[model samples]
Target: MFDTLIDQFWSLTLSGIALGFIYVLVSLGYTMVYGVLRMINFANSEIFMFGTFATIIISRDFLGNVDGSKTLPLPKLLLTISLCLIGSMIVSGLVAVFVELVAYRRLRARGTNKLATLISAIGISIVLSEFMRMITHSRPTLNPRILEKKSLFEIAGANFRIDTVLTIVFAAVLFFVLDRFVKFSRLGRAIRAVSMNEDASKLMGIDLNRVISATFLIGGMMSGAAAFFYTLTYENTKFNVGFTLGLAAFTAAVIGGIGNIRGAFFGGLSLGLVEVYASAVLGTQWKSVTVFVILVLVLVVKPSGIFGEAVQQTRA
Candidate 1:
């Protein structure tokens, strides 16, 4: 049994790492938005769901299909995916904006208590999830009939799927872009300032509303991209896809240290690996239960999370 496990390590580990990339990218949005706003974006999963649906609608329904099989050309397919990526981000961002504007932002404008904010977030999350179910109830739509899963090359007798490679690359690029934006961009500086001290930021002539809105937008965009990547890889989707995926990604965020961007990234990767290995050792049915147990243990030992800031020094 031990030797059997070791033999499967190379393949399973690599696959776990690749899959972890998805969680990492999506978790970033959770971390970033929470980091700045001190408010949990409960509807983030909807952002991802909408992103996948957005891409599906664009490629298959919005633009209609191509020739006999009702698909787009390679160039067009690429374009569709690209557009889906951007469109999903945009739409998700808008959805977040609306959530903020209608729910949290208004309450915030009224200076509501933290508990009230949480209640509102939960309410909105339920509404969004149910709304999605109502719209796409029980439909398992296929992804755009694009690339076949194939190997660019093999390493050490391990084969990598095209989707795996693309997911990793996309997540890396997103991390890089986000790192650059936060470190060097002016908007990023404002965000940091706002996160550090909203009152002071406001006193210093920064538009707090605008900055917070921007934070939601960024987070929404990340979730959107995650949604698109998810559907593209899996080749199918349903209205309820957001629930489990959201929970897992949210767990990753908390495990890494909620509000710490880098922590979220690693947390996501670690969670994915742990879950995959747990399934290997236990079984698929036990994967989630094992993951939750690990999360509980980690929280008991370290409430702040692996990489999260102990104090969580935020404006809140």
Candidate 2:
């Protein structure tokens, strides 16, 4: 019975864990930015899409070509990864910042209803995605690094690879560092205070603009890293790549409770695992449906999210 249970359950659980890591990395941005702004930047997804493509370009330049790309020296690989990560982070963050400056900042000053902001965000999202689609022609581009990594092990009878391990370990480290940054650091304190009461925090001499920008930067950086990890995993990308992934990560943000950092982490990880399991049980075709179902169920029970601020408290 135990052996049978292992055969039946371990596969989904392990795979879920791996997928969950990716989700967390992606979702962290949404959670962080939302915590401060209380505004959803729909274009955030496009920023992520940009990061993935940037990494692909960098990888191509570093390697010779796609199929026949030369492997970088280990030092170069490290440099490539670091430089690409930083470059993508800065690019995505700047885009996020620009969106705020152009689209949402003035409206926020006027105390616009979140609905208007959401619509504007969606508009920006569409424009950015369409522009990208036009630029890249909606074609899928390959990144062999993610797919080409050799499988490294069969842990507990489950196949695991270097990519899988790296994804998980990197995500864990990022989350830990972010948790510390948010909880123990001065910037984190400022961010939390603003989230609790933006105007009141301002009276306390907090620069709302700076705090908000910082939030975008952190989120953008996280999204950038996610771009790399995601590219590494799937090995190919295309225009609008960020849409579905962004929605899924946002769903994780919701399921875990928006404005709750830990909630995003748990929500993302949970969603990833659920997707993995769904692929095994219901077939991959129905997996997206399965995700929406989970979202609906979570909303019905815990509208505020698992670790999110209680609705009553936030309203008060």
Estimate candidate 2's alpha-carbon lDDT, on a 0 to 1 scale.
Answer: 0.78
Per TM-score, the best of the predicted structures is 1
Q: Give the C-alpha miss distance for residue 38 in model 1, angstroms.
A: 1.8
Worst 10 residues of 1 by lDDT: 64-73
| Count of clashes in candidate 2 | 4
TM-scores vs. true structure, each candidate: 0.91, 0.90
Cα lDDT for residue 102, candidate 2: 70
Predicted candidate 2 versus true structure: per-residue lDDT over 199-228, tens digit per residue: 899999999988888888788888888888
Backbone clashes, each candidate: 0, 4
Task: State the C-alpha lDDT per candidate.
Answer: 0.77, 0.78
Instruction: State residue 128's C-alpha deviation in candidate 1, in Å.
Output: 1.5
- Misplaced by over 4 Å in model 1 are 1-4, 65-73, 310-316
